[model samples]
Target: MSYGLDAHTIKSLKKAQKNEITEHYIYLKLSSFKKNRQNSQILQQIAQDELYHHNALKKFTGTDIKPNIFKIYFYTFISVIFGITFGIKLMERGERNSEKLYGELGQKIEEFKKIANEEDRHEKELVGIIEEERLQFVGSMVLGLNDALVELTGTLAGLTFALKNTRLIALSGLITGIAASLSMSASEYLSARTEQDSSRALKSSIYTGVTYIITVVFLVLPYLLFSNYVLSLAVTIIVAIIIILVFNFYISVAKDLSFGQRFFEMAGISLGVAVISFIIGYLVRLFLGVDI
Candidate 1:
């Protein structure tokens, strides 16, 4: 019962069918590994819905479609590395374009409309129920990442002009970054201990410290690789921007945030501080009569 669907419509329906089936398997795999009973049940329900949608489409198309194996592994790996909430939300974000397509097809087919509505309403509600520890400590991670970006970018910029040596700048940035990360972690642990358990507080601090150190490594890599301080400074700034872009994008998708505002605010502050610090470094070098 293709319902007299045109060739193009059949092709579109087949694509949608494939997506539903693939997602079904992905959700099934995720549910199987989930330790939380409630989360596992919710994921299984969503998977069942996806399978239902696939079967509905199969009735119309009169064909069977295999799930996308690569997508199955890719999303599962992402869910394992990143939190399940983030990974699933990211995958669902990609489905927005497909939702639009579903809307268009719904105008002609009643079944498409039902599928679109269920996808929009039910799956979202189910996905919202999933909770992960990493997401709960996102604030700690953000604090660490933001501080590292702003402080280290400025510190590196200032040192680049003042020291005039890439190796020296790298060594100075590494020392400063490590010290700051430790300080930030301790502060986070203390703060979290006021409101949460000792174990949770420890985890929060670890997240903050690890994020800060990783960011520090990325920003300092250019200085270690390049000979000229100015060139290394430029590359570090680029790396900083890229980090801001990626992190904000991940947050925006996972948390349903406005990406542009958070991104510009962060990047502006980091770079602005770097500029001011650069001037201060030059002034100090001139006035203090210090040579490196």
Candidate 2:
């Protein structure tokens, strides 16, 4: 049976069909990366569902659409590095963006409504079943990353004026960051041990330590590369802002939270600390008669 789809409707349908096929490939590719048998099976089932959706849409469009290969590998690589839950949740957000259009199309053809509902079900089921190891240690990551950002940003800002040399600032920041990362990891391990399994506690500590170290590297890179102290300080702060933006975006999508509020709140706190620290550094330098 052929439905009367006008040019505009056909174009829309084709776009959706392309999305379906692309997602089908993405899910199919990501399913292989899951180590947990149950999670793997669930991903496989979702992939098959996507394939079914693609075939159904193809019937309407009358032209077989090729999947977007770039998206397939891109999402696959993301899943490999960021954990399957993050990648899948990000994809779910994409599906949700088109929900209203699907509803509109449904008014013309009932099949779209069914597809939309199925997509909703997929998202809900995914949220419930996803058990990635990385997600389990999110609290640890938050602890490490947040502490590093706040502490290091303040420390670097203070040092920027007090030390007033790019090389010296970078060295000081590295020493401080490394020491803090170890301390934070140890504290996390002890804290987690009190509440959970030893293995998980160890994993939490590792996550915290790794996250802190990575943040430190990025934040300190500007100081290492630039000769001008003021320029290095400016670049370091900008890098801190970027890190906050990217991290908050990942968490917002995976956890389904408000990105703007979290982003602004975090950015404000880090910059505020830096500003206050900068002032204190200047006052201390003036009072102590430090010449470097």
Candidate 3:
């Protein structure tokens, strides 16, 4: 499989290679950051995952691949808005190619289909991406749910730490979680409904709402598991870290990236959040002399 590749697989393989390179570059760029062992371990895992993806792709396509540094450079130079726009454009291109790839493959002989290993074509893929993007209109509710889930869980954990009563914590968690959910759901629904095609938005929003609620329940379960506030808080953080790591591994497996590389990337993000939040919380407590 070294030189000649089916046009569809070529495109898919190119995209995969380019994405791996981009993640690798991003990881390398963070080399200057002062990281602890846990964070370093995560990055290593993520990088390894990316490498595995790259290698598996090369094995399948048999094409000698090179890093697309120019694309990476362009991405780094772009403003945040333009960067997202660029990503959308790439997604558009990928959707078209994928649709073409899959659609053609659908009509081929079963033997050919087995070789191609895909069923959808370029136009279908393009439409799918478009629909996915547009459908997020209702997904505004989903995103709101996600935000509430993350922030509220973190909030409940922090509050429980500071105020060590289960009934009190339950009341606070209930008020905060419900309020956050309502506010988030309303905002999501309203924003999504504003779109021209609500079908996509509606489906996306519903899926999002369901998924986010599921994630929130999982995040909050530690509190129910342990009666002690401090223990529950600790358990919550551990569970979150485990979930995030597992998610990283699953994503890596899907992309053929090694778990190690994905772990590192996720670990870095988690560390950044934990450090910033801890500093803010610590400073507030110091100034206010609040007891936990």
Best by TM-score: 2
Better of 1 and 3 by TM-score: 1
lDDT of 3 by residue, 1-292 (tens): 4434578667775676566555455434432231454544544454454555566555656665766777555544431322222333343343344344434544643433432342233223323322223233333533543364457555665566455665566667666765666555555556667873577555655555554555566667777777887777677667666766765543343233567865766555554554455456556666788875
The C-alpha lDDT values of all candidates are 0.91, 0.87, 0.52
Q: Order of all candidates by TM-score, from best down to worst?
A: 2, 1, 3
Candidate 3 steric clashes = 34
Clashes of each: 0, 0, 34
Query: Model 1, 1-292: lDDT tens per residue?
Result: 5587788878877888898999999999989878989889988998999999999889878889999999999999998887777778877876777688778878988878988898898556855787777778889989999999999999999998899999999999999999999999999999999999999999999999999999999999999999989999999999999999999988887778899999999999999999999999999999999898
Residue 99: error of model 3 in Å? 22
C-alpha RMSD by candidate, in order: 1.8, 1.6, 17.3
Candidate 2: regions farther than 4 A off? none
Which 10-residue window of candidate 2 scores lowest in summed lDDT? 92-101
Order of quality (lDDT): 1, 2, 3
Which model is ahead, 2 or 3, in terms of TM-score?
A: 2
Model 2 lDDT per residue over 37-97, tens place: 8887888898888888888888888889998888788778877877788888877767754
